[model samples]
Target: MWVDLVVEEILREAPSHRHVVNDAKTPSGHIHVGALRGVLLHDCVTRGLRDAGADVEYIYGFDDYDPMDDLPVYLPRDYERYLGVPFCNVPAPEGGGESYARYYAQEFIDVFTRLGATPGVYWTSDLYRSGRFNEAIRIALDRAQEIREIDREIRGSRGLEGRYPLHVICQQCGRIGTTAVVAWDGREVEYECRPDLVRWAQGCGHRGRTAPFDGHAKLPYRVEWAAKWFVLGVTVEGAGKDHFTRGGTHDVASAFCTRIFGARVPHPIPYEFFLYGGKKMSSSRAVGAFARDLAEAMRPELLRFLMVRPHPRKQIDFDPAGDTIPRLYDEYDRAAEAAQGEAEDRDLARTFYFSRVAGDPPRGFRPRFSKVAFLIQMPTVDARRVLERDKGAPYTAEDERELEQRISDARRWLERFALPPARFTLQAELPEAARALTDAQRQFLRRLAEIVQAEAWEGEPLHTRIHELKEEMGLTPREAFGAIYLIVLGKDSGPQAGWFLATLDREFVMRRLREASAAPASAGE
Candidate 1:
């Protein structure tokens, strides 16, 4: 629904409905999951435009021509020498023939591709080397003074008084980050590679004059950002909110777009950050989960739902260590139900529609993710059979596939990120904590053991009986459930106690309950 509103705005503002929606990233390291937010956001707008009968071309660029200014902590210390070199020129970490940028960039490309975002992929290095940016580079060089004035006016920056708006790769050291273009002649530029120019990389102090076109030089990012809009004909683009700040890079770039490049500024779609555990993620710093890993660990639709469900301006704070994954799956299922006309919420239906990678939302028995998670952890339980029974029908082929995918996702979550209480292992012997239970709690467990042994009980019926016994014994929910969990799981809480106990071996349940109930109560109790 937000995407539809954005599409309406873009269509109303642009007389020419044809648009190029673009997003790009510099692959300095393993791209974090946070970067996927921009990619998916752009993709959503692209799809929205197309659905609204506007011609749209979505382009994703890898800004590999950018220099590596910092060594990622995961890399060997010796990689420090590679800092300041253009990423396209550095060797891949695995010693393959691919450039360092392509190696990491391809890894991220695979992730977005899996999410069904197949944009026109391009490399910034190729654009430069192929002379696509030659004209823009010349424009920047010719208007260097004006560009300087714009930066000064907008950002109050005074550092570019004498320096031009370009940097050349040092002829001697091959490092781009430390070189500065001092003068731009009609055909050639004078530059210097100063050793002390930056703290991250040492320069060779090389000086040379060369043509500043055709990959020999690069415009500073602010100018390049505007140049990209001009060269690629991008009409719609968005960046993180930080860039759209007052007097920020986007402001300076917008000024350049209107003044220096003589091009209309692209429609802006400013978005918020995708935080992990409340902290913003970084690509080079290894601060959050890598995009590819998260993609693999989640169902494709569920991952898409996680990205597109929230408004672009709203921050998504995800912590897989808790119930985040299960809850997300639950929400995604609800949206799917709405999409299937099972609910009257149009917004939820729209969310489910856009979250889909392909085809109509499947219609069938959909189990709750939390239940699926619980069932998978029980070694003796047949999760598929249990779910089929709960559905009151045999699983259709589609239902089977869906259950299998959720099972895989649930197991991965359990292995990597599930919280302690969500994880379970039936105690081989009576847990020592059972001795701390109150007498009334033990009495409740003893009654539960009798009910479990009296006759065969399914998950729901057993669950109801557990609640009845808790009331009969005058025990609180915490005490009643705590007694069962303490004996079986050695924890204070777990999945629904009835369903959990019913899934276990009836003999083991009776035996653990007997042992726990018969144990002497703690002194305080």
Candidate 2:
């Protein structure tokens, strides 16, 4: 399994240090399908590692404590009373949960659970409150000199030099720019922020200058993160592509772990964004048509199958149309049929889709009735006549009941969950022959009705009827028997017509047939 590959890589690189997947948050916001993809990827890795005989731990961190300018004071103006509080400490729904840090963390966790991904959560505020991970933060800060040198070495070795800042995080305050200089063991290091760097927000009427860039400001953030992973000792983690962009927190964490706390960087798998209606998935906006939305419309298994293929890096374009769902399932079925003797990748893909489809029927799987043939079977037609005429067995009451319930449920599920029901309607007109007098199609329909009216219904009698009709009409068994489908459904085929008609109320079916037979042909002819 790929998890084994990751574990082997980690063990080879750092045999003594524990392995962990560092799951971090991008500010608390709406959960998107893209985020769900990250969760699934992480699950794959975690499951893979355990299968490979390696111990794995999961650590999901809330970066809510990180400084965020993107948020505004949505609450009443006197918000300073909330300062020094973590993001979770903020207010409820109205404030974007930005009133406190704890509130921010819980909101997204709720969203994640809805998508079927749960992580071992460690809040940054809890770390600060407990003051337990402080030692790791202090050590990483004390070694800021060495960490910077290593960073510079790595950058220079790669023949690229960029402006890199030297700073340590403050455990007391959550800021990253504390610059107080403290010397220990013949090494000079910054233990706090540079008061000189404090400046007012550009063009803002707010008078107070910003706090200086202090190392202590970040101590709380880094120590809490590094310490959580160190103790949890996780093996795999996944994140959205947002955090991996060129220079991001991953780099900072790498330096903190390798140079400071001396732990191995866990395998980081970055996933591409999941688009909704061709746009990047966004939590704050409408969910549009993604996995969760689709799950509501179809079966859970179908949604899972949707993500089974296409590597993590590959992009997906999904449509909510019911037609697309069946096609996708067909593809999944094809993969399953061809899975034997195929490569492991192919087998896994098949297994993945199979499990997803088998998991839960979305809203409820419905038959593909939108097709012209399916429409034809919707009415009560000469199905019995066709069956008797063609020597097919008649249907038992139980069989009839079951088939009727299936059809009714299918129609209901489609009506309830399908988007824009009008789009799937087939309103085209029938041919003049089918519309005017008894088309050969109508004749067969009438034949089935007669047999239903004549005998005690049973599977055998229906089969016998279809066979008889096939012989008399000189039509292939399929061609001869298909007329019943056309007569009942106003189309060429549908759920086995004889069985369908038997299950359905006879009067309803007869009335529908009368209506269909008398109806005039439309432009669709």
Candidate 3:
């Protein structure tokens, strides 16, 4: 519903021509997961507009002509020599068939495809090579003074008066940023590749005069962003919150669009960036969690849900270092339940629809994932029965399939990401710790054996009995549960002992408890 509001507003001021939703990124290296947010956001808007009977297209642009400004940590130090070279023209980091830009771009694209953001992809290099940007290029060159004046008036910066707005890829080294255009004759430009022009890479220091066509030169970022809007007719786009800040990229690009290219700027969807490990994600892959890292850690649908569930303005402080994936699953299932029935919480209901991967989401009496997570590790607790009871309805085939998938996910997630406190295996024998139990602790297990055999099935009633036993034995809940956990799990604590015992093959639980109570209480003492 919120996405509809965002989309309707876009269609309200929708382009008279083809409705286009566009986003751009330069694949300097392994892209941070933060980048996927824009892909999913635009995808949501695209789906919403199509549902409303508006024709729309989503395209992701790769600014492949942009120079490699920094060496990603994953690449060798010798690769730093390629810095300041046009990314599309540079060789892949490992010397693959794909150019350097395409190599990283393909990796990132595969990641978003897994997360379900499949936008039509375009390369900015192709635009320049095809001469599609020539008109905009000539306009920017001819009206350079106008842009200079606007910059001076708006931000009080000295403008590009004598110099051209384009950076020519060097004739020798093929580096873009190190070249400076000193003169523009309206049809061609004369440039000098000064060795000291940039700190990143040394220029060949060659002076050359050439026609700026067929990807020989590219517009500066501010001009390029504006030119793409008119050339490609992008109707809606978004920028990270940093870009939308005071006098940032969005401000400069928007102004350049109106002043130089004379094009309407795309509708802006400004979003906050994701922080990794409490630090702002750096473009450098060494700093933040990457798209592939998170994609493999959990189901992609949950990751996509994370992207769309939050308002664009809200900050998603996702640190999936511990039980965060389990918690995320819990939150997604909550939203999934809210998607069905009259969920008074509107955000919950709307997010589930946006979070789904394909087809209509299975509805009605959805199980709470947190509870299922706890129940799943219990070997004997009929997981389907626990899930069905939680769902309060018999599962259809689809529901059964969904449950099995989640069970596998929960198991994998616990073994991988969750902390030791949340993980366990049902024991085959009374654990070594069972021998150390005091007489009173052994008596507690004996009493729990009776409770388990009485068919006082858990989860709720079993959970209640543990407290009753605590009161009856004059023992702390910790002491009482510790005895049971040691007997079954070889630990001082584990999942709720009562539900756990009831879920076990009743014979296994009864036998384990009997073995534990039969052990010499003073053996370890």
Candidate 4:
């Protein structure tokens, strides 16, 4: 169920329909699974409100205007140029990617886009430059005495040293100042580059210097939060499970909005982490899968289903196999199918799975076939061989040309994203269905391999010849179909065996089959 805190806060504190959900960065590395989880939950919460007939504008903000830390010597050499600059001022990555924050933000949006979400974007730098974020800053400044007390309390709680900076960086002018002072002074911040300090690993030369608590120096991280919440009037936003803890930042932000901004936070939902391949997807240890990689491995639509179909609060341990991907979609398809029949609670389930209404919904909220399913269906191939093979697969020159295009697209996606594991496992004790391949089935594998190699691994003629084999063997289409799965998956059940094998080249399949057949009862460790 959606948490009521944000809604309650909004009713009493914000009172207006406009509010925003702020996802700020803390000088951490790029976004990871945590960001993805947050966006998904936010998407679901906002989507739920829309379903329930609420008109809420969800705005998302990126806090890119913070400073670098004392650990600059540890960063890439380029850190010298950007270390002391407000994070947003740091230039975007070259070659058409994003700045660190923007990169992660866009990654979050990519997931949202696939799931059909459309939250507006407002960079902190942009907001500050436009002079729209200072009112909240003033309120925070009025409570300067209180903020000092809060800082002291925080220091005591954390067992810190003498004092810490009360203000945050202004992405606009790139100055560090308190939100409280900025509201009253009405002075635009002035930025100065500290390249020498940037050169030193110890500290920015100004590190321990007693810089004044100018309002410009300290940004009301919370005030900015309030301004965003007030301006965009977001109805709902979801955050990590960690943020909802008692007395966490959310608690403080909630109070700041009510006491300072005279507004409420939106409906805030909390969500758990998703574990991929038996481990929680993480980017810190540099371990975990990314969305682009997942998309490349399969299809973007399947990844969307995996993300959006689940309830916001539940945890997901995503496994590429084990029927997890298809199972989720199957449930979706089931809910959709039952929505047509008069099944009990079918509409509710369908609403949860797909959209509430059956007809075409908004583009941001539509469904598609999963890339994972496509990956499972596509023939396994040695991607390098597909790329480098001088001789083409057995096919008419025209068909070969078409197949090359598909292979090239697939390879590009794979290169950018999915990681092909080092080992392939073939079951030692084959399933009953697989154990039943007839003599004709064996001949067909050989014939198909020959056709494939001769055609230079092209697609169409390979497809056409499979049907011919089916007829020549005097076997039902179903029986003839079983052979491909038996040989490739070592199981009787799988996606279409013919298309699956066709997707892969002979070398990849041959190696995988050999590995599978040669294994002991167990596979890779």
Candidate 2: regions farther than 4 A off: 1-19, 71-85, 94-118, 145-234, 245-252, 282-302, 321-324, 327-350, 353-525
Model 1 TM-score relative to the real fold: 0.94
lDDT of 1 by residue, 327-407 (tens): 898888889888888888899899988887876666667888888989988888899888998899888999987887788
State TM-scores per candidate.
0.94, 0.57, 0.91, 0.57
Task: Show the lowest summed lDDT stretch of 10 residues, model 3.
Answer: 362-371
Ranked candidates, highest TM-score first = 1, 3, 4, 2
- In model 3, what is the error at residue 347, expressed in angstroms? 3.3
In terms of lDDT, model 3 sits at 0.81
Strongest candidate by TM-score: 1
Which regions of candidate 3 deviate over 4 angstroms? 14-18, 155-162, 342-345, 362-376, 379-395, 435-440, 514-525
Off by over 4 Å in 1: 362-364, 428-437, 453-456, 505-516, 519-525
How high is the CA lDDT of each candidate model? Answer: 0.88, 0.49, 0.81, 0.49
Q: Between 1 and 3, whose lDDT is larger?
A: 1
Candidate 2 residues 444-478, lDDT tens each?
55665666667555445666776787678666655
